[model samples]
Target: MRIGILGTGNMADALATHWARAGHQVVVGGRDLAKARRLADRIGHRTGAGDLRTAAEHAEVALLAVPFGAAAALAGTLRDALAGRTLIDCTNPVGPGFRLLTAHGPSAAEQVAAAAPEALVVKAFNLCHENVWRMDPPVFDGRPLAVPLCTDHPAALALASHLTRDLGCTPLAAGPLGNAALLEATAALFITLWVGQHADAQAVAPPLSHAAGPA
Candidate 1:
């Protein structure tokens, strides 16, 4: 798969490295070409670093790893490049203070869909912490972590599922794109807990194992 990620941050580097290790072609882009290239060098992926449009154009699957605040402008830059392509929106709309910026009414992924009508947008990978994206995941009490996903497009969902599996994570289909609100809101809930505990806010959510439920 040709994966184009629109960020040079940890998420973009992590995913690009994993996919590249799994033998997929990966490219990462950002506003700073030098930063993107630095990340690519570290990840050792066959990557091309450039502006948003360049990355979007080179990918069959374009991932928006950008912060939600920049969603609108990034969407505009990626407009023509994203037509009929599967776009994975991994952003959460949190404010400068890490407060919820978007209402519970809709999710960042939905906003992306609205912004890019021609693209097939899917929401996934917003639940896990960047730490989980970094090192090889250790088993937590003998169970693997479940990564939730939501998308209206079956084909897009399948591709995401395969990619997640390749990264050694379980993919949970939490229904269509509309359900993305729950996923985004869940992140907010966890962040609140972190704030309350005075815990390290630098981390993302740790991978979670499913609890036993009523049979």
Candidate 2:
């Protein structure tokens, strides 16, 4: 797959590196050409680099790895270029105090979909830190990381699932885009617990076998 990354940030670097290493064609684009070039070069594997529109137009699957504030605007700007494409959103709208910034409105994923109405938008990969994504396989004590994706489009979910597997993680169908706010809100709560409270956010939930208790 030809993967275009819409940001030259940590998420872009981490995910794109894995994809490129997994034999996917990756083109990284950012507002700054030089930064994009540098990242693309670092990702190597003949990765391409250009401005944001170049990336969007060059992809069958585009990763919207931009900051939460910039995602909707960029998607809106590239609406025509993104038509018939699959867009994977990995951004979290957690603002200061670990607040879900889109609490009163649509979730960030929905906003992107509204911006690029013709594109297949999927919300995924927002739960983990970029550092965790950089962990090569992100398995813990033998269990590979599970990436939950929310999207109504089948093609978009397939692409997101493929990418998740490329990182040696499992893909979980997490319902449609309407449920994205739940994922976003969960991120906020986890962030608050993990960073602010210096607690183990993962420890808050029991394993699947214990979810219903005394399994």
Clashing pairs in 1: 129-204
Per-residue alpha-carbon lDDT of candidate 2 for residues 117-203, written as tens digits (9 for 90 to 100): 999999999999999999989999999999889999998899889999999999999999999999999999999998999999889
The prediction achieving the highest lDDT against the true structure is: 2
Highest TM-score: give the candidate number: 2
Clashing pairs in 2: none
Error of 1 at 27 (Å): 0.9
Q: What C-alpha root-mean-square deviation, in Å, does candidate 1 show against the real structure?
A: 3.8
Candidate 1's TM-score reads 0.87
lDDT of 2 at 70: 91
lDDT, candidate 1, 1-215, per-residue tens? 98888998877877888888888878888899899888888888466677777889988888899878787568766788998888998888866565777774567888888888888888888866677776565245666677888999888888889888888878888899998888888877777767656676435535334234434
